[model samples]
Target: MKFLIFILGPSLLAIAVPLYNRIEPRLAGFPVFYWYLLLLIPFGSLCLYLYDRGRSDDRRPE
Candidate 1:
């Protein structure tokens, strides 16, 4: 379960690149593909953050 959450960050990349591999739409003068990859930084961090938070909870006394 927790392992799956950790995988979400990379899994998103594996699943998303092909879907966003285009330049038709632009953001702040940047191609959608470029900005989308940049945007993933925080999103992927959030996924990893969530995974780490969940893992910490598992280590607490219960």
Candidate 2:
């Protein structure tokens, strides 16, 4: 369960950005979809990084 959640969390965000881009209308002369897609790149990276870090922290120290 933990592994699934860890993997799915970033995967969903990756999918959501493109999906949002396809669905959202343009705003302020910039596509909201593009904005979200761009934003999600770093955000997803951060999420993946944090998940991995947390998993590593859970290990019993040798």
Candidate 3:
């Protein structure tokens, strides 16, 4: 359902953070752990924004 998108964003982070909990790979001297978390901010926001956008039409008055 539409609600899945709302749940998916944070759920992905919850699952991904631990799975990706490593310091091997680096980006611009930042460890994978640090950069990946930084990257997720926008990704998570986009997911939630998409979810809200998907629901906006439903709430609009005719």
**Backbone Cα, N, C clashes tallied per candidate:** 0, 1, 0
Residue pairs in collision within model 1? none
lDDT, candidate 3, 1-62, per-residue tens: 66765757566676766767998888999988888888877777887888878878779775
Cand. 1 TM to true fold:
0.71
Which residue runs does candidate 2 get wrong by more than 4 Å?
Answer: 1-6, 17-19, 22-28, 60-62
Q: Return whichever of 2 and 3 wins on TM-score.
A: 3
lDDT of 1 by residue, 1-62 (tens): 66775666567684776888899789999997888888877777888888878778669776
lDDT of 2 at 28: 61
Global lDDT of each model? 0.77, 0.71, 0.77
**After TM-score superposition, what is the CA distance of residue 55 in candidate 3 from its true location, in Å?**
0.4
- The number of the candidate with the highest TM-score is 3
Pairs of colliding residues, candidate 3 = none
TM-score of 2: 0.59
RMSD of candidates 1 onward, in order: 3.2, 3.3, 2.5
Task: Summing lDDT over every window of 10 consecutive residues in candidate 3, give the lowest-scoring window.
Answer: 1-10
Decreasing TM-score order of the candidates: 3, 1, 2
In model 3, state the lDDT of residue 53.
87
- Model 3 scores a C-alpha lDDT of 0.77
TM agreement with the true structure for every prediction: 0.71, 0.59, 0.72
